[model samples]
Target: MNLKNLKGDVLELGTHKGGSTILFAKYLQNINDPRKIYAVDWFKGLPYSDEFGNTDEKKKAKGRLNDTSKEFVESKFKQFNVDDKIIVVDGLFEETLYEKLNDKVFSFVFIDCDLYKSAKFALEYIDNHLEKDGIVFLHDYSNFLNRPKYDWGIIKATDEYVREHKVQFTENPIAHFQKITSI
Candidate 1:
């Protein structure tokens, strides 16, 4: 995604505790742009429960999101001094994205939702609202390969959609985007 200053909107899905959002806020502040930066998450913890392997870690993560995430995200946004410019949507993308992105186009979107459904939802939004030449950076592709069967499913889905739609992709897009734009 385009990591440069004060351009179009940027959204991050699955922000664990707003760290990456904070970084984006700072960059936008540096460039003096009033465009919105959004952080969307359910904040209800991971989708699966104890059935998956490594139950303890998932439980602990759920406890943090369930218990302390709101205060932590608010505090961090203040600390970063971009609180007003950041839009926090505290729900699943299925619940919030179309409303949030209504009539708006984005320059950058990061998808880190890990789960197949959320990832697919994020990709759908990117497909519809992302500006021409916009970039979508997806995290956890390695997990998709090495973790579970469904992990690979979203990868195939995204690849198929991109190919069928004829989307352009560049490696290291966050950096390369500054020097380029779409046809």
Candidate 2:
């Protein structure tokens, strides 16, 4: 994907440990694109539950994947030498997304929130802010790896969004949506 051709900035809805954020920063840096990558996350593990009644037993039983902090992610960015290319936004999607990004436009949105409600909110925000020809990369839209069983809300929410909005979608190993018009 040639991100240079895309317009506006980048928004990453989930930044666990900053792996994907670093990858985006490195790519933007290599292309000499000056657009900023906004990395949004709670830095805590998954929430207890969402509005759609989606829950993870592992999260309930063991508090899964909560070992990361915003400072830790920042350190990773600095270590990767792409600190200047990324901004870390700390908070839940419902609490901080609109407030922080209302004035910004995005040509690329990476959604890895992993829950129905989180993914739904992220997609709702993108519906208005994403620029024409923009791309939405949704993680866990398919059970490609046959990984441990988890909530399939991402799939349900995404499919519902696509059907309701009549948006253009590509059903690859990793499903994605291309915004062709502004709603």
lDDT of all predictions: 0.64, 0.81
Model 1 vs. true fold: TM? 0.71
On TM-score, the candidate that comes out on top is 2
RMSD of each: 5.5, 2.7
Q: Please give the clash total of every predicted structure, in order.
A: 0, 0
Off by over 4 Å in 1: 1-7, 48-68, 142-154, 171-183
Per-residue alpha-carbon lDDT of candidate 2 for residues 117-166, written as tens digits (9 for 90 to 100): 77888888888888888889988766556654345467778888999875
* lDDT string, candidate 1, 130-167, tens digits: 76667777664434424542332345445555556656
TM-score on alpha carbons, each prediction: 0.71, 0.87
Candidate 1 at 135: error in angstroms? 1.2
Off by over 4 Å in 2: 1-3, 50-63, 143-151
Cα error of candidate 1 at position 159, Å: 2.4
lDDT, candidate 2, residue 157? 81
Clashing pairs in 1: none
